[model samples]
Target: MSAFNLETCARSNILALEPYRCARDDYKDDGTNILLDANENAYGPSLTTAAASSASSATTSSGPEIDFLGLHRYPDPHQRGLKRLLCNLRNTHHHTDKKITPDNLFVGVGSDEAIDSLMRCFCVPGRDRILVCPPTYGMYSVSAQVNDVGLVKIPLLPAPSFALDVANIKQALSNEPNIKLAYLCSPGNPTGAPLAKEDIRQLLEHPTWNGVVIVDEAYIDFSPEGSSLAEWVAEWPNLAIMQTSSKGFGMAGIRLGSLFASAPIARLLNSMKSPYNITSPTSALAMYAFSPDGLAVMHANREKIVAQRERLIRELPKIKGIGRLRGGIESNFLLYELLNKVGQPDNVTALAVYERLAENRGVVVRFRGKEHGCLGCLRITVGTETEVTRFLESVGETLAEVNGHDIVVYSDEEKREVEANAVIS
Candidate 1:
């Protein structure tokens, strides 16, 4: 089968439209001059940070009374320094100590912005279409629809696991000639299932899906194997890996997201993105977070979260309704089923329990009901051990209360049946 060419499947507006360019910065090089082009503070790293870095632990001051600097100027739009640090960090652990180049790195307001940029760059509103797996992140769909692009849905195979259907995706791509982009959420949001590495590699290798595959690896940090695609950005031009600092970094408030792709694609995405989208303070904070110490701390936290998640999965089943807790191969979130009337577990009916937990216990967990192929299940984020313990305690109380209510309702129905029989007699 012939693949869709630019002339065949390109969005009309995008093909015809002239590229938009923002005003050029006078100071664009990676240098240390007055540093005024992007309005960054001429000041360097914070004095407190310098002091802390150099001082011994015993001599360093504690608490929040630390002196900081460089709050008054605009941050680097390119985020070159931070990217260099991150590249080295990613290389040391994930790669063979080869730095991730600036061309392959793009830091945006958040992963949300990277998604939006991808949509804008590829989807020709009213012309081209995007393909997504069901029960995945909603942002892929939302961003496509917002851009006036059409969407094609290919749902995952159901439990005891929610695995990707590579055949179905291939079929969909062939069936629909208009698809310009394919969005995948690994360690999926609601399902917490990671797409199989082979499946991802297959999608990349397949001629039909070779255009653009946005792997939303937002929670990849918590996944068991870590990220496999970020290092392959240079090898695959059509590949754009979307990641966020919010999750493992515990800096969601900073709103820093990154896109890894070829330099040309990176430049195109940058063109599509809003100038000054990320604030100075945010860029500063993100740079700080990317520091070796900051990242090491995040890695420790991720390890802690993974441990806590395992504990939840093991301990949750002591409750009657929560028969057995299961999870995807990679992500930290867990989705467990409730015991149905036959004492057999029913995976599709946990929404009621989810609501009950939220209402009665003031606990909030994702209820994947009719929407995301989460038949009957509750999606709980992995929290700290203390938090998870508290959450499980609430789960126990909430389940008992729910079971009691169900028994009462069942009894009332039986009583009504008896009353009807008496009237008939």
Candidate 2:
């Protein structure tokens, strides 16, 4: 096996590029404000105490005082405090012997920024390529297109499991040395299953593939315990993991995404990122999210989501036109087939049901009929108890309206068979 070399992996021009420097780079904001440098509003933010107080309860702060007044000032460019809190959070969650430090972390606008940054940092436009498994996240391909970077697609091993094609990925890596990054979506989007750890390990331990393997763990917290590969970053310098506060922390509005990588890779991303990319409000909310109280709420909410997911598993199949649930039940959403009269996956019926539910009944769910191996599929997120009930009712009504028949509740034996087939298929 060859040693992982950042020099070989990164673009030649990026290695030589000098990052843009701002006034904050010269003098760090340490709260001693005799500030007349950045041309920020000295009068403070144009917000009332009443307005701030009303929204203060949304954060995990002990008191009602939010730092909304400081919005005029530029946020921390380095995000020192937030990174420290994130490091602590991951260390505690993963229980790694080697603790992560601020240097090993990169905070971006969202996972999208990190995703694009990784491409820009390594792949040369039009010359280098990245590998992705289909029936996966779309942003990877979108980012690749936006960056003008080439892409090589290896579709996930057919439906139901959607596991990574590890052998083929390694083969691609070996054959195409220009492929600098491979994006793996665990608890995959559209396909709720996770890639096996040993499968990922095979790619990481490949003798010739020196490019970075990025694991997007956007839904890891929703998965079973010990499912995250974050702790392994300490061991593999070429490994980078993308996590977001959107799914588990319930802070999607914050637009904060994290990248856990070796210190060098983290530092590289930090250098290239726009200064003040993360705003003050986003930082404050994220900090509170990491607080003890915030964590408790997150966990409690997660349990509710998991329970609701189980409810979805049990209830969705009982509906007349809903076929076997595809993919593993590790993420917040489920992907299942929309069956026709003959009980086979049918896209026409799926589209009719999806459109009717949204346009007529005011219930919205994604119609994923076009994605690889996801024929006649609808990706439904597990909502609150009330929301789930509404969805179930709406879906039944929509299916009956589309099919022009009364909804038939499946027998217990039929439901069991469908569920069992979902598990094994």
Candidate 3:
């Protein structure tokens, strides 16, 4: 008994920090099937091939609708075709040689793997740390903590306008030389807002900072055309831009995330990663997704989602207890606060509404009130036209019941855990 201590066995930081939980982990009630939890695409992939093949069954008479020849064999260790498409689409080419080769990119299972890999490759577990802009993405901090790497959290400036403080970040970077990775989520999770190009440039060009600046453009397609810093990575060797097929391409299940960086870093990540990380089916899907016809479907889906997001912004404010929206309407989601009769942000009221809507109404959105700068907030994904309408109606009903009523007493640890869950994957 005297020799048994879990705390002594595990690292101190690991014991102190909580593990990351996916949405499906905690909430598995019947109505929670309507999942907007993990910021997944409600609209499925640029399913041009799938559609043209058949609607009747998963398999076709000719063969399976999906490519299944190499089910027994290991998949591509280097997902070259996927990388080539991503590189071509983003136009990450050198001035002299206009071809963006597969060597310039590394594919991850999702952006989650890319994030974890960055920490692993750069930060030495107990000694080093990473910088994160909070009320942004949770995965950066979660990934750091998992690797036993410390975190320097500089939260984005508060709501209505959750902009980055470039000056503050630069100072932090200068002071914290141990910081090797800085994570910035453009069109940030829980906010749907993008960081300014000027602000990012300032951080990149900072003299004191030699660390990698990760501009996560997971939601970039929903944003303006020139907003992405992906192409600039060729010049800025220290810059690594992460984009996903999940968000804009509408293929969350495929789990193909693109990390475009300098040749050295890409090679380093490739070296560190497991051989055959991507499966054959995912590769086949990626092929169709990046093909000309598939891209058109994605473009069409993006346009529709953009329109729906705009409609949500317009209508959400009209519902009682749903106060002024907090984030920019750049991505396919809206971050807005739940209000009291007095019109201030109220977490108790917010959580109650969230719980009620999920338990009773079958509409599941993210309770972002726990996130910094998103007080009393809920992050609703931009679903199809009808789905958004259903969410709006559900919120209206739930608001009427839950508003101005605060009963449950949450422990301090419980509150922190709830807030901590605000981190997107």
Candidate 4:
């Protein structure tokens, strides 16, 4: 049991905010014919069968046909059905004894919305701050800036592991009472390393700090089983776990993200959010994604992604100018450095290759060279087998062209030796 008080931590204004009410609040639109409460285009959505077909196939789910006509009316602001389905999915997949309920969940446009909402709900603009572990997600910082919340920086413990500095984080929390939120990205964005549960527990159980500890498990599905701290939310009132259908479920287009927290925290977020934050179409698509067939498909696709990730790990270091693979293999992406002539990580070569891959080779990858501890690094998302093959060939060619020399292929033993001695720059 935690002694954290929501009213004490949340902004005074937010605590007193009277949420906006809409027509749906007064009258429920239970798919009745005489639905004239909310002013909507009664004629129905101007979408062709082709469009509906495209949408249905988007998630590869064979669920019920979408109600195109329902586009005229307002969507369920509460998203009760969606939340219930999500709860079931997590309860089964994560195999937790303490079952999750709708009251413990809040669905937003994306993880970005939940991130921004948490900042708005708890931290007062310009007065309060949120702590972030960099080489993690950029949105935490971006959302803080957008919300006018100050930031307390604590970069992850170097490369390879990219573990959280629990000691420094605790020290910062004790030093800064104004820090209302601490954002920890598990299987981090560019780092791809999951923060240890014990380190997170240290902050959660800190005797002094009462602020919320938000663990962003955006890529948890890609990591080993039982890695999520979602189950702990039941016990820790000051803890919130953010997950998404975007990554593993392949439903990014639906823009569905979930925040699992104490019932009080979840209710606060729901009260402050816009009435129809989620569109009808988005909800329809997401429902399909939560269906039994959808879950199977998602798991199958995840297996494919994991397989490709392993392939990249085994093969990427063999490339001539590519340095050692940085970060843990816990996400769909891989971060590796581009080496200069003397086998040193070089940002110049990384940027050049990034541009060439998109422009000349038609293979796009993100250049994360500017991020801390990620100099000369390119973040490559695992793609289809064919796509991976093309990328390997194209990147090798691009490196050779940039270096103005033929690529030096290495044997298994030589590759190991080179990787072992490669300098992290």
Candidate 5:
């Protein structure tokens, strides 16, 4: 094991480092007589966010009736029920080599907290460094800066499908003696492709990353199955897998996130986390959703989202000026790389297109500028079918207005042919 400078790693930002010792006076808020202390709603979970019950099917052919509730209480510090449900989904017990129990899991405010915690627990400030591959998630770098840890970015080799450069990553780990974390955001954020399983396995086996390898499966549900490196947690004590209900589970508003790791890492995370992390209502509702029947709803939703995502991919390119749609439909989000005559290999100015999309199309999409390596790309989240239709309509309108060309919506066959030709060329 590389000698980690324990003291430095422990010194996070003031918010993380300060001990929580609230005075009785501090607990008293100066407000009106009818004051609600924390400003949380007297009611719990929003009506739109609630999962349909077993006895009652809301999304049936009859009509669309959304049922939601409001909250009133602290959430469970340890999200016991939701953890079990997720474990069941992953088939944690079915592992032949290693047995994973609930002890191996820890729930956080969100995976953002887990990322911050990993930096706090592992990366020694000043001396130690953590590595991130560019064209990946930005949180890793942001969290490192906040925690005062060093960040080494090795841009993912864009050729041969934007795969991680294992050699460069290993070299960074070897050269940086105190390197503590290697972040892999699979089916990555803007690029939208899953890291090959074999490439991930190599990183786990590599001696340099015996520190901590965080596999952020934020978009895994959208990708092809059996691609997660989650099962490797038991085999590699240094590994941590981050999952979130926000993206796939349609619970992003709940702010629920999970960390799956070996028992030892789980213990440390639990010890460091703030008490009462999850509110009581959140836990109760999540428990309700975790029930075998509620899970069916989630799976059904996933299937619907996947289907709609495929439909979007097939239909997107017929609009003029749109080039290759670079991301995979495995997740709910699709990142399309636009073909701009002005877009250079490494220098596609995405913000100009982004501005055009927002003002001309009335669709809000994330534009990665030069800093993130996406020169002419726009990331669009997959919403409902109606939402998608509206989005495509917007795309067509925007293209027509921007380029003075007639918008030609392609049929399924036409779109596929274009994609195939685009790929071949």
Candidate 6:
């Protein structure tokens, strides 16, 4: 047997694609750790603080004491306990008459694993495709490309401020007829708009389309009440909801993502995913995070973060070059454009300001300039009170320094034309 060329063995689609670069990849440590780039909870959801400080407390006072000495063993392959806890939480908060069970849930190492596994189960390479909306989560497309799954991108409604294009989606499904999965990011990445319930209901009711609708509600905790479609999965077999503890529960380090779907879909995903993928510690932390005290902490954190988000919405426009604050008032992040001296979407300035804030001042926000309907825009994660204040000061300084460059004025026609062909790269 001859030695195989790894490159030759690699899938054709993946060979040409660039790997998804996470927030830490872009800016490692800016000394201040004012990391607003990744939509992470700057304030963590740990319940151990009370036990850590009080010297008079009993040894068992700390809730859900994790077995650190059990590192030699593997995690629970079935993850029944975690699933049951999640089921109870959903039943309580989702306000649905129907009950969700452990059988209806599938756990993964972040929603990325769930997304990838679903593609593996549903899509056929080269023959089948997935429908995606532009300026949504990068991972959906990246995962599709890696899985050699085709993409039918339907741009979001422009005039309505980046709402889901339900009309075009139906049209795409009609034409393609091979789209197996539809990835809808509610509280959409880079565009904090929550998907309209009626619009999603229409998609679920699309008579001709037989594909599953995977609604990524990773940021739904920050969204309004009744915004999430997780509960609807019980009624609609084809609807799958991807939720995460990373954003609201502050369990990013634990790497636990959830998929709430019909029992069959959940089973299929569980069957296809790697055995023992989630570790013991991660499972323990997640289970504890959903416990009574932990849930209380999560709610407290949401209130404070939402307050800061409102403060930013009220104050960020006061900065000189920030043109228009886009996206709905939802999620832990905001997307707003950076303008030039003559009042144009200045991609150059946005990029420069992002770099300046990250490299020089230790403040980091994402430059979403090239995303659809997000021209000359930056996506900033809502941080704690002190972090938000520091961000305002540093970002204001950077914008002031970068605002005076010669700008290219685009005609409305040209703007429309260029923006129409929105590319993720």
Task: At residue 328, give the lDDT of candidate 4.
Answer: 78
Worst 10 residues of 3 by lDDT: 1-10
Candidate 2's TM-score reads: 0.93
Residue 284 local lDDT, model 6: 75
Over the stretch 1-425, how does candidate 1's per-residue lDDT look in tens digits? 22424433334454455554433355553434544445444444455654544442433343222213233444446667777765654553352334458778878888999888877877767977889888788888888879998989898777546678899987887678667788888777776777776787677676664367778888887765536467666666667788888987889998999888767677766655666677766876777788877878988988898788767765665454565444473566777656554544554336656777778777888876565555556778888888898788877666656555333122455544433432100
Assess each prediction's global lDDT (C-alpha) against the native: 0.68, 0.85, 0.75, 0.85, 0.67, 0.76
Query: 4 or 5, which is superior by lDDT?
Result: 4
Query: Candidate 3, which segments miss by more than 4 Å at Cα?
Result: 1-67, 92-99, 404-425
- Comparing candidate 1 with candidate 4, which one achieves the higher TM-score? 4
Every model's TM-score = 0.79, 0.93, 0.78, 0.91, 0.79, 0.79
**Global fold similarity of model 1 (TM-score):** 0.79
Which of candidates 3 and 6 reaches a greater lDDT?
A: 6
Estimate, for each residue in 1-425, the C-alpha lDDT of model 5 and write its tens digit. Answer: 43322234333442254343323224432222333545555543344422423212532332113212213333445566678776766754333356556888988877898998878777666777888888888889899988788888888877326788888887877786667788888878777777877777677677534467788998877665556656667666767889887887778777778888887678667767786687755676666677777778888998889778777776776655666666455567776666544423222434555677688667787876454555566778888899898888877666555555564565678666676755311
Show how many residue pairs clash in every candidate, following the order shown: 8, 0, 3, 0, 15, 0
**Can you give the lDDT of residue 402 in candidate 3?**
72
- Candidate 4's residue-wise lDDT over 1-425, tens digit each? 34467889988888888888887777787546477767776655667767655765764554224444366568889999999998776774353468778999999999999999999999888799999988878889899899899999988999888999998998998897699999999989998888888888888888888799999999988987777777678778899999998998888988999999999899889999998999988887898888898888988999999888878777777889999778878888988989887878999999999999999999999999999999999999999999999999999889988888786467788888876765332
Q: By summed lDDT, which 10 consecutive residues of candidate 4 come out lowest?
A: 60-69
Q: What CA root-mean-square deviation does each model show from the true structure? A: 8.9, 3.0, 14.3, 3.7, 7.9, 13.3
lDDT computed for candidate 6: 0.76
Task: Assess the local accuracy of residue 10 in candidate 6 as a C-alpha lDDT between 0 and 100.
Answer: 27
Candidate 1's C-alpha runs over 4 A off are 1-24, 28-71, 92-99, 208-210, 340-349, 405-425
Candidates 2 and 3 compared: the better one by lDDT is: 2
> Which candidate has the top score in TM-score?
2
